[model samples]
Target: MTEPMFWMSVAGVVLAYAGYPAYLVLRRSLDPWPVVPRAWTPPVDVLLVVHNAGDALEAKVANLQRLDYPAQRLTVHVVCDGCTDATAAVARRLASGRVRATVFAERRGKSACIGDLLPTLTGDVVLFVDVRQTLAPHALRALTAALADPSVGAASGELVIRDPTGFAAGVDAYWRYEKAIRRLESATGSMVGATGALYAARRQLIGPVPPGLILDDMWIPLSVADAGYRIVAVDDAIAVDHAPPDPAAEERRKRRTLSGNYQLLHRLPRLALPGAHPLSLRLWGHKWSRLLVPWLLATALASSALLAAAGSRLYLTLFLLQAGAYALAILGRRSAWLAGRFPPARVAAAFLSLNASAALALGDYLRNPRAHLWQTTRYQESGR
Candidate 1:
């Protein structure tokens, strides 16, 4: 039983990283995403949140103004949350016609600020975005029309990481895999969440996020979906942001996000409960299983080592393979030759960092959920 369980854990990892994505490509090939016509133009509120994004606010505003959507039907609201810098000032300077700016004095977390401010906005659809990404000319229109099905509660746009240098990064590869998963989920009309960088929701579905919560993307879309509406992914509506320059930053971001997954399952236990959600199997396979990856990896490593010690040739080979990959990850961190710029190093490094982050996130979750929550709010206040 132990040996079988060990192999099962190994199979889970393979299925996750390999089989799942292939299944999506096959599923997509058989049934592609439905075409959403651009004709369904509706009043859109571009709700942008920023901290100290003074450097990028003006250009981002300009980018939005360049969008193909009708100016009369579109309104841009930039909310500056505890921005000590000239973020609000820059936005206010850029504010003209349909663009507006508001400043929040307190350093509340984004979820709280958005929850508080969402009530004041009146648009047929509220499109949420961060200050970093710049959308394509017709991205907004595509997103709006995706919701024309009326069955869609929210529509999440694809994010394209700017890799102009064509540098190979593990997170870049991961996003490609993630995009396929999103497409599969969208096909079933049960994508679990939206990309916070660019996604739109029905105005009526907009509501106050829970206090002390992070990951508004996951929470908001799930909330809307619970009301019997579908969450779809729109690959045509693409937004661009630069990829993280280093694995350290990527790990930090993943840690924060993984920690929020814990909180999400806690806050909305029904999401993980079988028969509770249409996406329950997918959630476990795509999202929640990820939370167990570190453990799965560890168990696979230990079990193989144990069996190898008892003179199993196959387990010995597996053990050696695991050891070699982990060694490569350590080398990737220390040597420039083995760094994230190359595919092997990047893939190995990304795998190592991701599992390490999962362990750290789980540790943080266990140690002090409230304290971590407090720290996250502080971080989100400054860095977002």
Candidate 2:
């Protein structure tokens, strides 16, 4: 085994999980861009696109109504895309001067819904919220307020898992860690992207939404940065949802998202490494590096095995440690009791599942597939 290959593989793993996070912390520590939240609540319009979401449509509408923003200032548009169920009915029941419902006879997917909705939005700020989460009363206000800073074209709210007692707790913790990185990245210059669960963008800045499976969150934020604007993360603006009871549903959701990342990177070539994309540094270390991790992991294992066979005692120990971590992952899945008792095991397992999902996502990207239309991963788990 070449020593350089072995070291590079090790470095790749380090850079993705540890090095990048460390860099974010250090960068934020050295130069903090303070974002003072303002009371200037611009007119916020919510465009909610749904496909076969009849079960939770009423609850979603209720959540929208409950947000702390002014009744006159907040408008909700629910677009039911080919939903054969009571999705349209629920939306119609809740429709009023403040709430409106749009129905499409055929399913063209989320991208199509977004494309149709963008032109109709007249508010100063347009918020895109997924049907799966309920926004905290202040989510709309905080996200919209951030746009008061002219440099920030878009802002994403923090998605918080409302409950955390089972296997899902590890998943919730994982997101918390991710939010931390986003906060630092936003402070430094621009966050690599926004969360679709709850996020807002200046109406003038939003152009045509890309058609197909590309992630709107990443594309919109990156496009904003490309147009000389920044995307900030609004931590206090929280959107709450139930984490999946198990990793199965979460894996499917991640597969779609990670694949979209792969597809978006290709669609927007400027975001790739060695390109002039202003967010290239953050994208490379934070985003592309994650896409490459499964391969790096395989290389690390093989290289370590070869080195061990060649009598390198240190490599042998490293290989054993890797093997043990995988063992813990297996245990985490097979025994919930053990996982609950030892949280570290569950976190390690979730990490493995995430990377495995990324590998599946790469395959999905290669197949040149269309995005799934409005299938919330944990919809069933949430019992909505």
Candidate 3:
């Protein structure tokens, strides 16, 4: 085959495989139909995991107090691990006795902290909430109602990024698109993973996470799914929080997330279990493939570069196009601040940010295969 033809063929194959799956996810996400059932109240335990979360504890506690569900039926458990700051002190000051505060001065990972608190949970359902975010008043009811369906082992709310400033608006838009796709996947059946900021599951469905698991969001949902129940997304249930103001801070967050994805892929190979639903497949396509995308991207790029240097104009053009597309995406997101608009450019930026972080994460994971303690980034103040 001619050099040009070979490069064209390779590009076609990659586009057909990777590009098609992404199209399907985007198409499904754009469908504007409701998937969640109407709200009904059920007893649930609200698990708030905190580390050095000073005043933010107060806002989270206040949000919990404002939940539309019966206050008596709801219990809030705050797990404070390795917190030297007044996080524990602030939580105690706000506790009405309905809130149980578990303070551990010794630093254990968040996953381990969660494992420790699991046995103390007495509610029929447990909802994990990040101290930095606030749950919608009706989020609990919606999540609980979804859990009422026996097939749903866990349910997560829609995440609304509340950064009104342009600093992280790009990040917010990216999440909006993601949430849309997640909803569509859920409607088709099951969510790939629950949002860590706000997700609820049956207490019995909870299992011990690998002590070093960095991505509780991925692990918890996968565990529930492996147990034969669906991991669901409830669109009506919403949690509002801001993205990290600094791009560097956001990148740091993504790095940790990527590392967790790698760890989970290794520890929970059961994601390939039989009788997997479409949502599970979507999860695999959208997330699992993405975990290895960096390697695939790198290989393709290198191969294209070599083939082009060997006088394959077609292959060189294809490789350059892909690279240019990513470059434009990044530029578009960064330029949004100047233009005051959310454009197609931002979408490209979001993609670039995600994949770039994935690549960095793979490098970091390779360097340190063992689980290590890492600090969570504090982006915005948690309004108590």
lDDT leader:
2
Ranking by lDDT: 2, 1, 3
Q: Highest TM-score among the candidates is held by which one?
A: 2
What is the RMSD of candidate 1?
Answer: 3.3
Give the better candidate number (1 or 3) by lDDT.
1
**Model 1 lDDT per residue over 111-140, tens place:** 777787788888889899877777899899
Cα lDDT of model 2 by residue, 1-384, tens digit: 466788999898898988988988888889877665677777878899887777877888898899888999889999888887788888788889999999998977787788888888889988988887888988887887788887889999988887565457677778878888898888887898998888898888876786675588887777788788889999889988876766787787888889988888778767886658888988987888999999899898888888889999999998898899889987886677877889988788778888888888988778857664546444444432
Candidate 2: clashing pairs of residues: none
What lDDT is obtained when candidate 1 is compared to the true structure? 0.78
Per-residue lDDT of 59 in model 3? 76
- What ranking of all candidate models by TM-score puts the best one first? 2, 1, 3
lDDT of 3 by residue, 156-240 (tens): 9888877544436666776776776676657655667888888999989877765666888778887787787887788778988
- lDDT at position 63, candidate 3: 85
Clash number by candidate, in order: 0, 0, 6
The stretch of ten residues in a row with the least summed lDDT in candidate 2 is: 375-384
> Which regions in candidate 2 have their CA more than 4 angstroms from the true location?
379-384
TM-score for all predictions? 0.90, 0.95, 0.85
**What C-alpha root-mean-square deviation, in Å, does candidate 3 show against the real structure?**
3.9
TM-score of 2: 0.95
